[model samples]
Target: MIIVIVALGGGVAGGYALSYQQAQQSVLKTSVPKELAPVIAAYETVTNNYYKSVNTTKLTDGAIKGMLATLDDPYSVYLQNNDKTNLDDTISASFGGIGATIQQNHDSLSIASILPDTPAKKAGMQVGDVLLKVNGKDVSKQTVSKAVAKIRGKIGTTVAVTVKRGSKQATFSMKRQKITVDTVTGQLASANKQVGVITISTFSEPTVKQFKATVKKLRKEGAKSFVLDLRQNPGGMMSAALSISSMFSKNGQTVLQVEDRNGAKEVYKAGKKLDDGFKVTEKTAVLIDGNSASASEITAAALHQNSNIPLVGEKSFGKGTVQNVGEMGSNKELKLTIAKWLTPNGTWINHKGLTPDIKVDYPAAAKITLINATQLKPGDKGSDVKSLQQMLTALKVGSVTVNSQYDDATQAAVKTFQQANKLDATGTADQDTLATLAQKLSAQLTKDDPMMKAAVDAVAK
Candidate 1:
């Protein structure tokens, strides 16, 4: 038996479906088509007559990519090695590793955030710690993706990580655990305790279960109305979406329509097969942003069209096509667009995102750029310095002027921020300083997120 994973949305973040079928004979046993003879001839000529020994695998991968390029579809791609591993980790939303989000700006990689109760947090790995080595391999100059590849391994395996925290260096060794990320988070809205705000980051296989559990728990906490936040959710498994959409839909209600290449349409509905019969009868509102796509769009549209739930925020990320991911072994995979998905009303959102019923844009502070300068002293002057100054001004760190020059005022403000945040008061914007500044700015912006406020207001009304 062969199993294929079908998906919808942007490549990395999309809706997925599992399909099982009998394994077919390999194409190698069959005769080649006449049209592919030229390809075979080119391959033979390259390997047999080339000036140097040819890497057959490289030639094969390039040919596959060239064929996919003709489709001009970004979702349809050939992933190799680290890219393939990243995709699998993203889809599963679980991995065996020290749980932390690594960020790479320029040549430096550092811990962006550590998941709670994970090995990284339990091992006392703090944010902004500059990654120096992973398992004795230097990753200070590697990209975040490569660093993550090195950090992840089989569960129960021990890995050593050395990082520079402030002016000191520390090493931690911990056994990797199978970390299942909590994609769905819920709490009573701070503005309105009666309103439960549930945010689904992505639609993974475990997302539906997590969402249900959150809803149940929130309902017990005196939540009357609800806010479903799908902002920045790139979508996930189709089963999860349908099951979640069903929570607000009646049994047998149309959830979405899938049309294959042959133009045959299949309707998916909320019932025993796709839904678990759990329903949310409270008044609800949905929040969507430009990054909400595929399964996110599906659930948003379902709630809006089925139960008249209002969608608040900017337009969604338009992505309605479905893909099938085929494993080709050798740490490679081929993701190909296979079908088109539509809303219950049969609207194709491909390239045309769903318009929110109530549009609310993010505040300017939310767009504050990150400081990427490795170090900025009193004499530095550049765009990076300007960004630091701008962030400082926006954060109201001090009465510092927003300019390209990192003068004495900027240094004083940086020092003040460092002292307040418990960081070393170096008076210079180093990696630790810059990362802390970014995190603080982000936290402040999130506290006053206008979109979240809008969603709560919509639910209240």
Candidate 2:
């Protein structure tokens, strides 16, 4: 009997007898017993029909690519010759393209971030920018891989991209080049302040070296309190995560723990030279969001569990599984899940993400009223007037006298502060009033607090 299968826009026919006999002989070589012949024969009969139809054509490159696509796993698709070369170059950290991270959103694609000092950043591409068209063609209907192919090209080539940022649509003609992204970025949080912020985009091959150098530089700049931003970091090398965690930990401490499939557990410890010159400050905070994963989680967990550091922002995307890339012959590779990782305290933060120690949400609407306070206008009344004037003066609303008076200056100053902080601007500190007042007071106190003052005062120390 003959069976025909159609795929990749082509059709081929193969004889069942010939394909089945070949599968049986191949299985027999694997030492299958005679009693299992019927079961093995049945399995091969179905697979043979599929395989033969795939190999029916002159065994061209298209057949192999099509066969892999039938698997329907995005990460399991076969890379074309050119794509294979590009993949190698990307993992090697050298690629010719506009420097941007992209992710598939629904049917369209969006820019996750534009790397600093790259063409995309120079061209003004921002996060949440929805890619609508590429080279004058509608990209809203294209797959992520198809759009990537359209966007990436030879060095010095130019590609036009149209994106929608919020309600505004803009086009940018970006010139592609060999972009090498610095996985680490560091700077003093506020030059006058002694706080430092370092943003690690990924735990790539060079991350450990880069992170060490960055910390040393920041420390020299009088950075006493640090904010390590792993907000959108998706993670990379495991060794890099261990090395990074070591910078903040003392010797003979476990950074993270891993459990293999057979229930075997291993604890990864900080090296003897860990924290060589960097002092672990008690006020360190790790910034994380939904995108931070894998190695980033490992670092965050280590700090939160074993140290005094606090984690801020939203929960992370928990991907604690360790994957081992196995080379299957013929230039193919299989990335298989091997083990799961736990925090130093033995919490399995997989699927269920790491919760923040402090959760703060950005205000969602402009119409939200924060504060409420009633006052008399210029040329007004008695006891109420005295109370209003006193409150306004206390809030630094104006320089006007508060002796049982209602004045225009006080109301004007109140309105200015309200509007500046995105409040209702009614000149009344309404429902949202106390929170704003508290925040202002906190900020003021933080600036002159004895701890911060001492840290800054010891610039020579």
Candidate 3:
């Protein structure tokens, strides 16, 4: 069986360990050949002569993983029970967790992004927040997969998390719930009403269906052109990608090419019947970024090649390979890098990813929230002043204490903020300064994205 998925996690329950042991027993019976006598001798010696009580099951699993590791293939990995389960959940586009995307960076597992309205977001978790501790146990040294397992739990169960945001450490206890990820969402750009923006979080079984529905809704709501946003999408099912691409491509049109290890080639083409629901007259721009990988690249390439849709934003993540997950044992699955994904135009998009037709450098400024107006010159004492101080602190303004009273120090900080933002250097917190602060705060919170702005411009008649 072939399945595509993107996830990071660790072991499951003890049942998996037993299933793995049984699988190893079966493998030992047949997989090793007579030329591997040395290996068999080593295994027997370790089992018979080792002084400590050795876990033979773990040793066997480790041996299998060690053999695969010698191939030096990053995509090939030992899938523990939890890893398999996580893959399944990712493929289905739902799981029980706090709804934060985690990635292993240089030295730590940090929050790559937070899914809006999920438990993570509800708990005020922000992107780049480092996982400090889980349930009071320091997990800074744990792998991304292991940390994810720690964070995930049964629905409605609460997990305590300590996150490090710069020098500040905040602990939060949040309830875990089933997170249903919306792969496709559409909204008419507020800045350009004629241009609709459809953000595809990833390609899953439900993605194509959601994309079709969203596009239809946008069209009915007077969206004349569209932007397909694939920024930060880590990719999912290949079938989902192709099916979604068929919406914009002609029937029987070549969408992608696949070349396996044995040099066998296969071309995937749109079916005999196309999705006529996708209005051809509506121009499209696909938004891509460093996180756009695999199926996301396929969709971007297919649309750009077949329909001349302009690609906007940064170059893609360059993960243009297909992973086929096959069953190893009853409950164990082995994922192998089966094929390299080729564009319809026969470009091999491997390590060298697809470059966007239009390169747009959007500002990565912090999100801003519009704050309530507080007209205060000085000698102000109230909760509003404290709120302003908090907002100022978030903007990295220095020395603004979170006291309810606003003194001369508060005025000086306000002046500094105004100067930095290129507004009039006013010493007082007036309407203009408050409005500017609100706008700056609001900038950090703009989820619509500036890439959509460039895309709208490209499609605007």
Candidate 4:
């Protein structure tokens, strides 16, 4: 598909999302001090004596941003109208745009992910594919924001995008839609029937609700233990994180300790208000990686501190400050870093990240070719059988051991899976059956998903 790269109309945030909570706050109202006479005089001079007509809104916005810049905090900013809209979309997990995350690579803009069920994913845009053009406009030299603006348009409008995947180039005509992003996904594991896994992408407004409902459903479906995966999750909502942590922790357990400017501290504890019904099994684990930040770190710290869940994977991205996004008049916003949050044990996780209880690096995927089979009966034996077994195991299908042998057990599992998937049940692992299984099993894990396996092992052991 030839995706035309064009010059965009507006700038876009790179994978923008916000972690925010609206609560009863005590605002210390202050009058404008006399120290700002110089600033007001400059504004008056520019408005009155500037050579041309001035945009007072732009000037005021720039001035507010300039004042914030003196604080040396990147998170604190004066949000313009568009910036506020983006933040709102991020917090709500719904936006009107082509749902694909792009990152600037060494030499090109590469697709990082295509949001599920979105036009980008439907058009078969794969991760790591290099963007060639948008609507025949070359985007090789354009900034990500500029490129994104060009890619996004009115709902139902079509945009052509060209990308280079390996040695071949393809173009796709994709329509913009109102995409609702799901932050949490879950599944039962084949390696261990007792364990269910949940991966959290971010802590949006609805994330805690999703987490509770999915986990409860998993429990009802016979999942005894659970693995909470927070790898690559650039965190959102502090309140959401606390809510999730409360499910695992007992009442009165500390969720966070906020230290304000004057060294005053405020401790947030897990209350007994929410009773997430599942009895978190003793083997429950929390997974973390370098990209896990803010609220993710909070959740990890809370779970490990109170429930003693084994945190598995690499160290997290330490971002412990709390930012309060306040409405600045009309459509403007002001995100100010009000306090620094500490872990339950009073450890400050600023630039220094939290260490996992079981620090295991990701293992390499086993090299295996995707195979097609007509029908495998009880007597089949080979690498193909082993590959099928591996895939099935990752999907948490029935007890088909990866021993390179298709026995009666394997056939039984195949029949059950086919029946559940609404496929013709011939008690065999055929090509169509395997493809259907792949679709259902893609998000849970792959044949060689090292982290998923580690999580399963951590609990199973």
Query: Using lDDT as the measure, which candidate wins?
Result: 1
TM-score of 1: 0.76
Clashes of 4: 19
* Position 25, candidate 1: lDDT: 22
> Per-residue lDDT for 1-461 in model 2, tens only?
88986453222234445555766676678876655554545455554555455442323334445544665433343333222212112211355788776655323467755555566655545555788888889987565567677888878888777787655565666778887767788887553557766778777666777787887788898777677878657676787788778767766678988899898998888764544444454367787777778889999988887675777767998888875655544544444457898888888988888888776442221112211223235566565455445444545665757565555665676577678778878765343433344345334432333332232232313
TM-score of 2: 0.59
lDDT of each: 0.77, 0.62, 0.72, 0.71
Per-residue alpha-carbon lDDT of candidate 4 for residues 1-461, written as tens digits (9 for 90 to 100): 99998764433211111100111111113354545655665676677657899999989988897888788886676655444522213311343576776554334566654544566655545555688899889997565666777887777887877787665565666667886666778889878888998877677777888887788778888887889988766676788888887777777878789999999999887775543443344468888977678889999998998888888889988888998988999867788899999988898999888898888775421223334354566788976687677767766688877788988888888888898889899987765675565445554434456777878888887
How large is the C-alpha RMSD of every model relative to the true structure? 11.9, 13.3, 11.7, 13.9
Root-mean-square deviation of candidate 1: 11.9
lDDT of 4 at 271: 73
Residue 192 lDDT in model 4? 84
Please give the lDDT score for candidate 1: 0.77
Candidate 2: residue 379 Cα off by (Å): 47
Location of the lowest summed lDDT over 10 successive residues in candidate 3: 85-94
lDDT of 4: 0.71
**TM-scores vs. true structure, each candidate:** 0.76, 0.59, 0.68, 0.63
lDDT of 3 at 136: 81
